[model samples]
Target: MTTKSITIKSDRTIKSIMPPTKGEILCKVSGHPKLFLRVNASGAKLWLYRYTHPVMKSKHKLSLGSYPAVTLAHATAMRLEYEQLLQQGIDPKAHREQQIKDEHKSLASTFEKVAWHHFEQLKNKQKATTLKRKHGRYELLCSYLGDTPIGDIEPLQMLEVLRDIQANSLKDDGTPTDKADRCAVIASDIFNHAIVHGYATNDPARIVKPMLDSYRYGNRPSITTPSEFGQLMRDVETLKGTVHDSVFHSIKLLSLLFIRNGDLRRLRWSDVNLDMAQIDLQPMKGHGASKLRMVKDMIVPLSRQAVEILKAQQAITGHTDYVFHSDTATKNNIINENAANDALKSLGYQGTHCAHGFRASARTMLRHKLKYDKDVIEMALGHITRDPNGTAYDRWEFVEERSQMMQEWSDYIDNLKTGKTDNVIKMPRMRQNDIKTV
Candidate 1:
């Protein structure tokens, strides 16, 4: 190999230089010591930075990059940077390797990767429905900021994501939905998990909560009056033998039981006891991030009407695990979450009554008209109403009273649908003296 001093003034000048006939040659760049343009016999040109190791005091060469890609100006700039590192007793090659290592680590610690890791840890801790919702929210955030490192995320960036969600994500009622707030909560949980595992230093989501719009609760639209509810019952009767036959049965059962939509949709045949006339459902009340935490499965006292609906439904789906099984469903074989709601919409009840509206209707009529015990009504609705000691009442505590209440409620609904005047006579409130002394 031969070395010569050459001035590479411009891009054209560098291209004009020719390679050696048999061996490689080095042309020193003007005004930058130890920086050489290496030309090979195969016509390949590369930039090399020859320097002494700051600690070892031995000469070494580092490939700056190739020519054309690494221009004359750029190669000299790298040579200057390496000289500064050598002055501070640092090896430029080792420094570059450390930076590469940090880049790889940052890629591995992205917000999306950290969030999924957190979810994996929660498999046994959270309920399936809650976990599914959390994952969906995480995905919304991941779509926007998945590539960002969790440790590098700022509060303002998180706020911007939340603002976008709040602005675009709307409900059928044309109102801002709670999806943004829920997403913020999930992001905070992910950051907290990342912090625990050393992937993040702080929770940007936690810092930005006050900056986002507060979610407002709205009552689901429902037919509150007896006449309107009776008409709904009649309208549902007209939907039998249609494509929504399963939803028709589900709607009828919703009216009779008034359970949460998720609980009813995910209801399993194994949970229904036809002989006992009750449904032992593991309610999704106290799952991940839910305020109302529950430790026991809710026991719903099935009314005669509800039992009849279940029996009819059992004949069609007894071979499947889910009572609302659908062969075309993508996830679980059960029906879609909005199946009953869509069915209600098709019945011209859109914006008036929904599948979830059944619960509110039942609560109002059962309280004002039926006059059932408040505790029994609440418990039957799968609400966790605690006693005086702060401990929740046992699911079976009000079973007998709820059974009577449920039977009465079902009979009243039947009376309404048939246009009968069988108003329930208010049961006399029992006093302490009414109880027989032992």
Candidate 2:
């Protein structure tokens, strides 16, 4: 005799059903036609959805879940979803497998993983100091979004993370808006990398600018006037007690060269051509594509005074590759970037003067006091300026004129140091014909 099949009404009804003597028993759920509760001879109950693919025309069985774990209501809902997929001519089993694979991919392609890849690309392109700062920013990003899937990040979520960074990352003055701005930029770059590598679809950090506080551009504190700068020089000359001779010379060269602190710290003996009276420099700033793309070899004409400073330094660090080798073995081989600024602080010029401020001091005095060609002055400071015709001026152009200008500038500084204020050299006038019309 054949037994009739029972329709499953609820959980208790499912529990009361008896297993088949030989194999398994299939009980149909009342509202879900394709959904069934299968009970094996050992009473192991499971939910299954059986259907035929409209396109493939083949019977397929998809396991919704085990019984009790997946209640009758959940199994019904899952069956309905699979039935909809079949109606749309999609293979439900294949679709479910693809979903599992996508989830695994998302777990592996996390924000921190992509960020490290992006940082590796910058190691050779960016300066050491800049790389250090960017690494700190990356750590901050990882703290909040490290494990999150890059593709799953949303704009609002990015804004929330950035806002937290802004609010928490405070200096003595207050929150550093620049930190927030920089973090946002770094996050955007990571997302851009993710998109290129197929790990993400959109850059959520791109649109987060409007959510951050505005940052004001402030000039570095500097002694702009010649009188104050002269006093600063005299103070530097008389710097006494505990200051290393190498550091003192580094300060003097920084004053004369006005190069970035990073470039100054990384200076090498090979970069200086004392016999030729020129210093070949590769500035740390403006060397990358994002900032200015002005990364090229720069030539600085050395003054007799500047050349003498290098000659004296040779007595100490000439044996080493770096011009400013560190005294301690635990530290970097070269002088730390903050050594010059710290020396200034020792001389009571902490907030008023900095190592980088020398650039400003030279730029201002070169324009107002020395009366040098603006273009030549800028080139002397390793700045990239353009001609009136919109063409970038060659970095090595006007080498002769710049050499003379450097010599005269050194002489002017000498006069200031000797307190011979009255013996100012009359700057040669630029010929009217030599001046280009804008």
Candidate 3:
């Protein structure tokens, strides 16, 4: 009996047999030595063929590929070509795999893609700042090395970033932390995550170590001496208005608050009790927890100067709840951490001060000049210092004292802004407690 050829569309319907099912058709394609048609559940059909290596007698199969894409005529032609190759002792499958590998060679995989995917997989599994930090690293990686394929990134490329960060070495400030060893670990984690998902062949980051005894850490901008700090404050006082005076007195006041620039930027009227003259700082994520016992419900008795600055800021940007808003009607927060630094730089106060430097400036002045106890000053600045008594105690025990401390602190900062004498202001008596205690 002659075997009937399978029609591309005909289902063996005329006889008692039902239309050929997908499994039957698929099996036929896999088993056929010459030619066969397979139909899928979606009614899609394609042609496939089977061949034996003439030299090795090894059986193998070849797909003519998808229909319409591989026209019947082209498939027939390809089948004849494969037979010719088999006759010539060439393995068709090996050639196709090689072609596949070559087609992907010119493409480069980026760390950014891996970083983004890493974050996506880790979302809500960690702190929000982790997301933000990873995102920033993603941008830098993309900007700097996104064009490189995942498998091609080398240890040298990563070490160079580390060296650049250690150099503070970038602008005058040296290598930013993005190039730090810790940051390198994060970069490795991103590549490792890709390896987990099969996107990366290996993590180049793993070649770098946790800590190198001799490798210089990232360049950290430090105050180092009180005199240089004083020079910085004196220089800051000279900052004047730009075009619309985008740099205002409030931004200067914010520099003294010295919380994360973003937290200060988002400071809202709801977060502040002006009648009580206190700023209620909600503990921001990523910055270590505020250790002041006064925090949570802590009342930052606004200094006369801080209050004045707030009031002045209120009058101008009252349209929103933020005391110091940006020009773009964004939230009341200051947009640029760089704004304070830039303002300082424009005034010839180069690397000596950063917005964060204000915290150091205040802490140092409180210690040396105002004579506020270390804990009180640290608490006021949202820092938690170990109690010398060897136990965790209220860092800001004297609210009245702290209120006085903060007031003095504010006045001193205002003095610096106004070009007043360079003398460090004295802190007021640490208040024991006046009110707002539960």
Candidate 4:
């Protein structure tokens, strides 16, 4: 017996169709050529479109959607769209697949997603503090272009975000121009990362550089003159009023050690070897021009003055692991990061002298005044200076020279502090012919 094909009339008629005994049955829809209601053995009614590819001249089946979910009227509209694509010499199946692929590509290329991928690459290589700062800048960028595709963001969009940061981020006196510049730099790095990884084609942030405020170049505020530095040392020795004694000692050690503020604050008693007269500092990751590969502990040859200060500090904070232990509850029980600087400000050295100025002071005097080797002084400052042959100095290079220099430096500062050094080095006077008369 032959089964007759019935035209689907309404939603009720479509739902009333019985499943075939073994396979699926396709009931044709009236007034629609290729559209039909498919009733499967499992009792699911679906819409199918039977078509011939214009290019291949072969038949193809396309599932529009399940029936009831996609009504007869909706299936008719879809069939019309497929017919339009056929008339344009396109395969409906290939077109739909291309659309899905494009959508996935777009999602993967979004600014937020791509930036996060770039950050993951950096999180392993950078220090924890450096990563924290970068994460903060990334969050700000995401606030503006989180959902935007990385390739779609233009240079103007990046500039707008930077302008907003420049205007909104305030310091005590004015806008933080340095922070705005940093944001631009970080955005450029992210875009570069995206370009390398195929998430973007161009760096929008690179073009925004000319639009940012020009950074003013000047020396870091420091008491480089010997007499001023000597007086600053004396003031630090007798520092009183409003500054905690622990903070005072921290500032003293900072001047004597001339290490970075973070390094000093995070100094552990375990890292100090008074008998060896050395500080085996771990590789500190932050802003610096040193090209030394951080493969091992940084050796800081301690001066007798530095060792004595540590011995005294051991009398107070020796029980704790950190040399600069915090009195109150806090993370790591280390002293506050700004304690040394705040003590400097309280000593009336706010703009003229800073905690970092100690490095500058030691670097200048050790090089010019005391006539120490430049490479040894740079090594003492933890900077990677190149040798005469243009090779980068190793971390442990000039160990004995640095040790002697550290001793002489401490003794020189002692002479200056006690006003016993009358042989202060003077800047060479310019000759009459060498001076340009305006």
- Give the number of the best model, judged by TM-score: 2
Weakest 10 consecutive residues, lDDT, candidate 3? 9-18
Between the candidate structures 1 and 4, which one is better when assessed by TM-score? 1
**Model 2 whole-model lDDT (C-alpha atoms):** 0.81
2 or 3, which is superior by lDDT?
A: 2
Where does candidate 2 clash, by residue pair? none
Candidate 1 lDDT by residue in tens digits, 309-399: 8889988898999999998786778888878888889889999999889988999889888876665666777776666556666778668
- Between candidates 1 and 3, name the one with more favorable lDDT: 1
Residue-level lDDT tens digits of model 2 in 243-299: 888889989888887878878788899888999988788877632331363436688
Stretches off by above 4 angstroms in model 3 are 1-149, 152-186, 189-193, 206-246, 255-260, 283-299, 327-334, 386-391, 394-396, 411-438
Residue pairs with backbone atoms closer than 3 Å in model 4 (clashes): none
For model 1 the TM-score comes to 0.75
Model 4 whole-model lDDT (C-alpha atoms)? 0.78
TM-score of each: 0.75, 0.76, 0.57, 0.58
Global lDDT of each model?
A: 0.83, 0.81, 0.59, 0.78
Q: Put down candidate 4 lDDT per residue, 244-308, tens digits, no spaces.
A: 65677788777777878878888899999999999988656544234242323568998899888
Q: Candidate 3: lDDT of 413?
A: 59
Off by over 4 Å in 1: 5-25, 29-31, 39-46, 66-73, 97-151, 167-176, 185-203, 206-211, 243-246, 268-270, 286-295, 317-333, 388-391, 420-422, 429-438
Best to worst by lDDT, what's the order?
Answer: 1, 2, 4, 3
Candidate 2 similarity to native, TM-score: 0.76
Tens digit per residue, CA lDDT, model 3, 371-412: 766666656665443444444335335567777777776776
List the candidate numbers ranked by TM-score, top first.
2, 1, 4, 3
